[model samples]
Target: MFKLITELKWSPDGCRVETIPKGEHEDLPERAVEIAIQLSILDQSTGGPNTGQQPEQPEQPEQPEQPEQPEQPEQPEQPEQPEQPEQPEQPEQPEQPSKKVKK
Candidate 1:
């Protein structure tokens, strides 16, 4: 009496069609059991040579507390830029030689 972990469908003797739902089957034929084993759909404790991936186990219910991140080092305040010195006034250019008016 093996358990079919997955659905099975077949037509025995090319006449009687059968569909076995997943559950314990008390009267499954030897050939049907062999097919189930070959298909890796039988409920075997060893899960013998299964290639399909199993469902992942759920994560723990309680999440671990995350450590508080250290506060970023306070950015140093930028120094105030020094005021530029005022420029000295330029001396007036000497007057050009007065041009003699040709009357």
Candidate 2:
């Protein structure tokens, strides 16, 4: 069976953290310790300064309604045309007779 142990150590000023392996007494690498310290600082600094604050909302203006106009009435129709007058009749003249001579 394999065994693993993890240990955490904090600096005196509370600004840094160091991670150590304790089972076989092996020293942790410098890069791992530095990363742990940076993560600790970030966790401590977040979420306290901006608590309970809301962003401001912009105000919008209301629009006015326009009134509608009334429609006009239609025009009257035109009158029809009148009928024409009848023409007068003319009289005819009599014909004259021809005379004959004796032999």
Candidate 3:
């Protein structure tokens, strides 16, 4: 919430305040301003003229709820290896014929 503007002038007999913030006008202070002028006209007829900002509520606030986790179990399958037997091939031996004795 932001919006303020308290200005008044008339010094000499009494009155010369200043608050500033909304829009700002500045001239320095009036010295002691404030003898009560309907509370500065009820702060300028309440809201709207501030123009300094502050006023836009719609709706926001809601988020809290999270807790749930439990489920995990599945892994088992491995077994297959058995097949090897083949060996038969051996036959090659025949070479002997050489005789010569005559001198």
**Mind giving the per-residue lDDT tens digits that candidate 3 earns over 1-103?**
2222444433453465344444323222322212222244223333333334432442243467676666667667756545654456667666666677778
Pairs of residues at least 3 apart in sequence or in different chains that clash in candidate 3: 15-33, 16-33
lDDT tens per residue, model 2, 1-103: 1112344454534587654443332233434334433444212222332224332332233467667666667667656544654456556555555455666
lDDT of 1 by residue, 1-103 (tens): 5678888886667789798899876667665666676677888763433325442442334688999998998998987775986588899999999999999
Residue 50 lDDT in candidate 3: 33
Pairs clashing within candidate 1: none
Off by over 4 Å in 2: 1-26, 41-103
Off by over 4 Å in 1: 46-103
Candidate 1: 10-residue stretch with minimal lDDT: 50-59
If scored against the real structure, what TM-score would every candidate get?
Answer: 0.39, 0.16, 0.15
Per-structure clash totals for the candidates: 0, 0, 2
Instruction: Compute the lDDT of residue 21 as modeled in candidate 2.
Output: 42
Better structure of 1 and 3 per lDDT: 1
Candidates arranged by lDDT, highest first: 1, 2, 3
